[model samples]
Target: MAVTVLSVNAQQRGNRENMTPEKMAERMTEKMTEDLKLDEAQKQEVYDLNLESANKRTEMMAKEQTDKKAARENMKADQEAHEAKLKEILTNDQFVKWEEIQKEQREKMKDRRGGGGRPQ
Candidate 1:
């Protein structure tokens, strides 16, 4: 009984892993066709467009992520420089306000990290 269960589980896992990208694309196309009210010609056109869009999106997302990473590094360097300047410029009372502002900015960024907050 245990052997049978193990075999079945292994087969299921293999089936899942064996799914081709073409099959996945076909399934996605079917879903999109249903949602978009696509006729046969329209479906083909939309599928082609969607595939193109998906490729473009993938490329753009990768580049955007790279840019974001680089920008974040630059911002960190800038923030460090700015903080040093601020420390030199601000009195004790002004420094307290600066700290509060930093705290607020952190809270705002935390809310935005998951895409629920305002535009970055």
Candidate 2:
């Protein structure tokens, strides 16, 4: 039983680590659609945005970067660009709610990482 549980957990972790951009986009779109009550058009737009963002993130992660500081700066720039696009795509209320959701996710991630500082 213990072995089975460990194997299940490992499989789940592997799935998360190997998640594709389309899968990530679909999941994010579904969550946003449910949370924001998005229209079909809005859902489609959000999905496209999410897919693009996920692709960029995957590309960044795949890079062989010797300079951690440079990688961090690049990531920060990418995040800013993504937020700007989201602001344009979402209504004012939706944007506000999205920000709140992002904050909550960040906090949860921090807790999961044992209260580590922001990722470099």
Candidate 2 ranges beyond 4 A from true positions: 1-10, 118-120
> Model 1: runs farther than 4 Å from truth?
1-67, 112-120
In order, candidate lDDTs are 0.59, 0.91
Cα lDDT tens digits, model 2, 31-97, are 9999988989989999999999899989998989899898889889988998899888889999999
Candidate 2 has a TM-score of 0.85
Q: Using lDDT as the measure, which candidate wins?
A: 2
Please state the error at residue 104 of candidate 2 in Å.
1.1
- Candidate 1 CA-lDDT value: 0.59
